[model samples]
Target: MAHRKVGFGLRGIGHAVVNGVGRLGYASRFFLMILIGSGASFRRIHLTIREIYFTGVMSLIIILVSGLFVGMVLGLQGYETLQKYGSESALGSLVALSLVRELGPVLAALLFASRAGSAITAEIGLMKATEQIAAMEMMAVDPISRVVAPRFWAGVTSMPLLAAMFSAVGVFGGYLVGVVFIGVDVGSFWSQMEAAVDFRQDIVNGVIKSVVFGIAVTAIALFEGYDAPPTAEGVSHATTRTVVTSALVVLGLDFILTVFMFRGV
Candidate 1:
């Protein structure tokens, strides 16, 4: 009996492993199709532009407000901490470094995932559920080329701009609290920040992170939608999954990228 149980358990484990690999293979095929389809889909620039308007413009207000609040908090906390050491002039370095190096890209991606990622997943999932995707296929249209590619490309393009705006607004907010509210010297705030925050090291790296996160979050959103079961419940579940999965993937990628990008620093 014990031997039989062990054999059954081993078989179950192997079966699970094989199933996971099969799913991974299917996902890879789907991803490859999107990449190949994206080329000709560019001709549908109008559709991509519409998607950008939906994803980027619609989300701008929230991103702007969140950036400002976060910057203000950082300014207050940084000033309070540094004042104890009589290094209040370093407030600029602190805020800029925090925002550019880490907070800006990560927070923007998180907000994007919560806002636009969920919407994309829900939209695609609804199309799948309503048989719109199938209808396109029945008409000999490739759904990936016609539907998914444009949205994917739009998201990849929009993320950097959104992140840059978030960082810029956040810096201004920090300036308000640090310089005007707290009486920190304006010259030290700007000059110290300029001297310490390297465009290449901090700003460029943040942009790279935003780009990588954008690709990752958008890819996950599209995948979840495409793979959703053709049911209302499935569509809802995929939307939820997009947000949760995007968050995890962004944080994981941020850690990995940080280790590689700033290891020497």
Candidate 2:
């Protein structure tokens, strides 16, 4: 009995590994197809706009509020620590660096994954489970063009906007804490930020990172959802996997981007 149980467990593990790899392969191929088809379906502008309105603009409140608090905390902590070393005047530079280089993009991606990724995963999974995708196929409608394209564009377009909002709010939050609570000189703070950071490279890097993160999130969510097993339980599993996997991918990508952006300097 013990031997049989052990063998069964090993078989289960192997099965899971194989299934996981197969799902990943399917997702990769599906993403490529969608990417190709997206360009060909130029007449779907209205659908794309609707997707942007729903997925991007609707998620603004959470990103802005979270960013504000994060910046306030970072500024307060950084200011207090720097005060001991007489570097408090560098608070603006510190805040700007944190926002532009790390916090802004990372936080926005996390929020986007949680808010938009899960929704897309669940929606697609449900459609798959209910055979809605099949019905669309039967009706001669390409689901990739109708479903995946809009989401892909929405994710890519929204990411930059969300990242910009995060960076702006974070900087404003830091300024509020520095001036109103920490007693920092407003002019000195602004001067330090202006002198220390290059807006061009920082902004460009942030926007680029946002676009990458958006694509990743949408791709992962759609892949998980479209490949979900044919059951309600499968839909739930897909949603969970979408959130977890997207979050991990975002973090991993952030590290890669950071290394590339700051490799020599």
Candidate 3:
């Protein structure tokens, strides 16, 4: 009986592995389809612009508020820590580096995933559930070219800008807490940050992270929606999956990218 149980367990494991691989393969093909269909978004431009209004503009208030609060917290905590070592002036470097190099990209992406990513999945999934996508198909309209591609491109475009704004606001918040509230030396704060932060290594890499994160989150969201079962329950589950999957992927990618980008530096 034990031997038979072990065999069953092994078979189950193998089946799971194969199932995961097959899903990955399907998702990859879907990503390519989105890429090919993306031409309509670029050619028309208005469709993509409309998507941007939803995914980007509608998301700005949350992004702005979150960035400010995060920066203030960082400035306070960083100041306290640096003060213990009599390095309070380095607070600016600590805050700036924290935001630009890691927190800014990671947190911004997380917020984007929860907010915009979930919305994309829910919208597309609803369209599927309601037979809108099928209606488009019946009409000889390429639904992907018309529907999915614009949102995909809009997400890719908006992520970098949102990340930049997050980092920028965070820096200002840090300055407020450290300089105005705590009375840190203004000159030392800015100078230390300038000296420590490398444009190419830190700033550019952060932007790259934002872009990659954007692609990953948007692709996952669109795929989940497209693959969702045509039901209300399916759409809801897909929306939940979009946020959860995007968060996990963002964190994993952040670790991998950090190792590659910051290793040996």
Candidate 3 off by > 4 Å: 1-8
Candidate 3 has a TM-score of: 0.97
lDDT of 1 at 207: 97
lDDT of every predicted structure (CA atoms): 0.92, 0.88, 0.95
List runs of model 1 lying over 4 Å from the truth: 1-16
- Which residue pairs show collisions in model 3? none
lDDT comparison, 1 vs 3, better candidate: 3
For residues 95-191, write the lDDT of model 1, one tens digit per residue.
Answer: 9999998899999999999899999999999999899999999999999999999889889988888998888899999999999998999999999
Write candidate 2's Cα lDDT for 1-265 as tens digits: 9999999999999999998898778888998988887963458588888888878998899999998998899899999999999989899999988898888998899899989889988988999888999999999988998888888888888988999899899999999999888799898899999887776677788888888998999899888888889799999998999889998999999999989987877
Q: How big is the positional error of residue 143 in model 2, measured in Å on the Cα after superposition?
A: 0.5
Could you estimate the TM-score for every candidate? 0.94, 0.93, 0.97
Clashing pairs in 1: none
Order the numbered candidates by lDDT, best leading. Answer: 3, 1, 2
User: Candidate 2 — what's its lDDT?
Assistant: 0.88
lDDT of 3 by residue, 155-254 (tens): 9999999999999999999999999999999999999999999999999999999999999999999999998899999999999999999999999999
**Stronger candidate by TM-score (1 vs 3):** 3
Best by lDDT: 3
